[model samples]
Target: AQRVTQPEKLLSVFKGAPVELKCNYSYSGSPELFWYVQYSRQRLQLLLRHISRESIKGFTADLNKGETSFHLKKPFAQEEDSAMYYCALSASSGSARQLTFGSGTQLTVLP
Candidate 1:
């Protein structure tokens, strides 16, 4: 079974402060990891993918295969960055692709 874990349910940070959201996963085989974010009233959108090796909105996440972790980080936090973040894992289940998501982490950026 594949599982995604986000240890924190809520994280508060001041504007311009650095922020990191923790995430871990458990899967037998190689897994595809992704970070998804949902703004106040917007639809959920892809933040970053481990395979992409790119950064978006100053946020970056590296997949640590040995540690089975994919923690999201941002050097500087912005109030606009506040949102509901989710860690997800995609793996093959039989003949179909299965995605397992963490409970979610609500980030609040205070000015």
Candidate 2:
């Protein structure tokens, strides 16, 4: 079974501090990994992907294939960056499956 586990349900802290949103996954095949973020009431946006090795919204995610994890990290979080983050993966197919989202970690950035 493919599963994504985000241990933290909520993370609250002040602005301009480092933040790490942990994520671990289990899958038999090589699946595509991604970090999805939802701010306020907006749609979920892709933060980063394992294949891309890119950072978005001041965040970066590293895929540790051996560890079966893709943890999201940010050197310094901003007030505007406060949002719900989810770790997701999809197995591509003739008809690609929907991105499975984790429970979500509510990241709150104080003023």
Candidate 3:
């Protein structure tokens, strides 16, 4: 079974401070990891992925196979960046592929 873990359930930082949300995974095969964010009263949206090698909303994450981690980082967090973030793992079971989400981490940017 593939699993994703987010150590921090709640994180708080100043508006201009750096923010990081830790994510780690355990899987037997190559896994695709993604960061999903949901703002207050908003639906969850895809933030970034390891395969894309792209950054979104000033947030970026790198997949480290050696450590089995994909941590999301933002140099300067903004008030708008405050949201609930979830680390998800994509795994394949025969012909069906599914996404397993972590418990989630709520990030609050203090003004």
- TM-score per prediction, in order, is 0.94, 0.91, 0.95
Clashing pairs in 3: none
Q: Over the stretch 1-111, how does candidate 2's per-residue lDDT look in tens digits?
A: 788999999998788889999999888888789898899989988788888788777789888989989989988879998899999988763346887778899999988
4-109 in candidate 3: lDDT tens per residue? 9999999999999999999999999988899999999999999998888898989999999999999999999999998999999998533446799999999999
Q: Pick the candidate with the highest TM-score.
A: 3
Task: Give the 10-residue window scoring lowest on summed lDDT in candidate 3.
Answer: 90-99
Better of 2 and 3 by lDDT: 3
Cα lDDT computed for each candidate against the true fold? 0.94, 0.87, 0.94
Ranking by TM-score: 3, 1, 2
For candidate 2, the 10 contiguous residues with the lowest summed lDDT are 91-100
Q: TM-score of the candidate numbered 2? A: 0.91
Q: Distance from true position, residue 75, model 1, in Å?
A: 0.6
lDDT of 1 by residue, 4-111 (tens): 999999999999999999999999998889899999999999898888889999999999999999999999999999999999999962344767999999999999
Model 1 clash pairs are none
Estimate the lDDT of model 1.
0.94
